[model samples]
Target: MTTDAVDAPSGRSASFTVLTTGYTLSTGPGVAATVSYVTDGGRHVVVDPGMVAHRDRILGPLAELGLTADRVTDVVLSHHHPDNTLNVGLFGEATVHDHKAEYRADQWLDRDADGHALTPSLRLIATPGHSPEDITLLAGTPDGVVAFVGDLWWRPNGPVEDPVSPDQAVLRASRERVLAVADVIVPGHGAPFRAADALL
Candidate 1:
């Protein structure tokens, strides 16, 4: 089936909206980033910045919602994949936070550098399967808990696997951790789902 972009608000809260930037699939290319945004009290945090092509498109719709990248106080990455972290540099002063294991100097999140604190509502869980630096963000919102699983799994299609990959075991364990706590699942490249029991 052809892919299309989708956006849905939390059923429990009217203030938060989840936007999907769609995915890019070509002859040899895999899926692109599925960026997610969280808005709380005028503060914004972008989960998984994705690549440059998706960056502008991701931020474009925000303006219509009365939000802008400049207003983004935090950039939370689910992992260190280029598709997820490429546009991190776009947010100049925004505090970038991610799994300490996957962080790089060039990437947005630099502990030595100044940025915003990790919101109490959000917790970072290290899920290393797709990559050693892979992680998932658990957000405690008024609507419920949302887990942004970057590359850990995809919507409808299920988990993306690499048989010979070293972190296969860790990936499975990580998936369990996410499934046990998240009420909603936001994959790295598809629409958000309300599957509290689904796991990779």
Candidate 2:
């Protein structure tokens, strides 16, 4: 199947201890997950760990920062898709978080509206439809709110956009939700791009 994931582009930094994975993944060419990081000084949070087969590529950025998997404080999966969540086990001892709904049917809580806190700044948003449990992370950095949005879609015709999904309405709604809020978008695929007032 054609997927939206593209090799993350290089030389990009977002805000508040976050760095974009330049062409994330070691799986040859057209396929890759644009993994990102959100660090709070001492603690490191990794987004979209990518495939377990390409763990090194996902963890490579952390390595460059003089960190190993043990240094990771949290592993946040945007969803359980193999390209995004397969490497969570590599972050030894790090707390794993995802949209709670993935595990249960009831108790579906809206963390964003409930003022659920992740740090002093990071807010968890439940954005379904890419998969039922896709989560978009919003970190309040000095620059502005940078959102780590997983598999919402690819850039404007750059490459990859699944023509149909099981829940097209939900995906569009979730994408709109992110666009309404985030200043910078670290998409599941492609390079980090500006999203505030950006055409969907």
Candidate 3:
């Protein structure tokens, strides 16, 4: 996956820019780890670190932007999929907060890894349809709330697969949890959206 500078759509607040770390399976040409960074004072958060295949490429652009993994305060994973989490250990020093039920402590191991500390401000809303561990991170900001919804739904142009994992009920509940609070919906792959129509 290659990094690209996408122009923020009109009407969006100019304080932040959404940096796409290439496409992944869930997004087709649009699938990607949609990591967002606020250009100024807000906390530095990486929505999904993506797989090892695109790790260096993803971080390289951040370096050019004068940002490093160590500087990242939060690594929010939408789910427990390997593509979104395989490289999580790389950001050893940052607090790795995820869905409490989905989090596995052993996944944080590395030779020089700094243990992760979970934060309560960010709530892990259970959204399990795509996978049993799928959950969205509800991040509250002074402006509004941002929901990092992993594979809950793909990019509008991406393939539409049924989110049926035997845990469909849980997944539906998760979607509701996000719909209740998210002002901005940032999926695991593809672009971010502001309206409910954008989510479907």
Candidate 4:
């Protein structure tokens, strides 16, 4: 809804802004999910492109900011779940990044530090649990480490325990790991939250 930019960490010339389409799905009253877009310099970098039907709602906000789908350089998926990855193919010009086990493959970053460097300031993290191949995008900007944790949790409400998840224990540990470092949290299915508030 807003075009808010964050200063790139370590004095990189290019700055980026992360805008979410708020809550897309209408599963129930108060049960809405989010699909996020990161404007890294100029190209649009999207994560967890929710439902295919909600494509316009997601892209519409980006268009308002002057970035378009054709400029999306990477469609980084957090997991194989349809709510998160099914619509990834919509970004025809972008490469989909995730572990091969769950969905499409190609740019796989196996380790935590091996993030897919979208720009000098932004990258992706392999955060599994919601699914074996789940990942999160980490943007090192002046605001702090902004984590786009798809399916890792449902924001202010907390973690999800779906029958599909391989290991909730690992998810718990990953959440702790992420919270310890992240300043801003953009959950898969809710509004953005502060990591500090979640820790408390």
Candidate of highest TM-score: 4
**Cα lDDT over the full model 2:** 0.62
lDDT of 2 by residue, 1-200 (tens): 11111111111232443333434333235556767778764557888777533567666667887888888787777877777776677776676667762211233333332223456566667777767777777776767677787776544222233453468778777777776666787777566778753444
Clash counts for the predictions, in order: 0, 1, 4, 0
Per-model lDDT: 0.64, 0.62, 0.56, 0.64
Comparing candidate 2 with candidate 4, which one achieves the higher lDDT?
Answer: 4
Instruction: Summing lDDT over every window of 10 consecutive residues in candidate 2, give the lowest-scoring window.
Output: 2-11
Q: What does candidate 1's lDDT look like per residue over 53-93, in tens digits?
A: 54567777667677777777777887666777777876765
Regions more than 4 Å wrong, model 1: 1-15, 24-30, 52-54, 101-117, 160-165, 197-199
lDDT of 3 by residue, 167-194 (tens): 6556555566566666777766667777
Error of 1 at 7 (Å): 26
Between the candidate structures 1 and 2, which one is better when assessed by TM-score?
A: 1
User: Candidate 2's error at 183, in angstroms?
Assistant: 0.6
TM-scores, one per candidate: 0.75, 0.74, 0.67, 0.76
In candidate 4, clashing pairs total 0
Lowest lDDT block of 10, candidate 1: 1-10
lDDT of candidate 4 over 55-118, digit per residue (tens):
6776777788777777777777777666666667668777666654222245343434334466
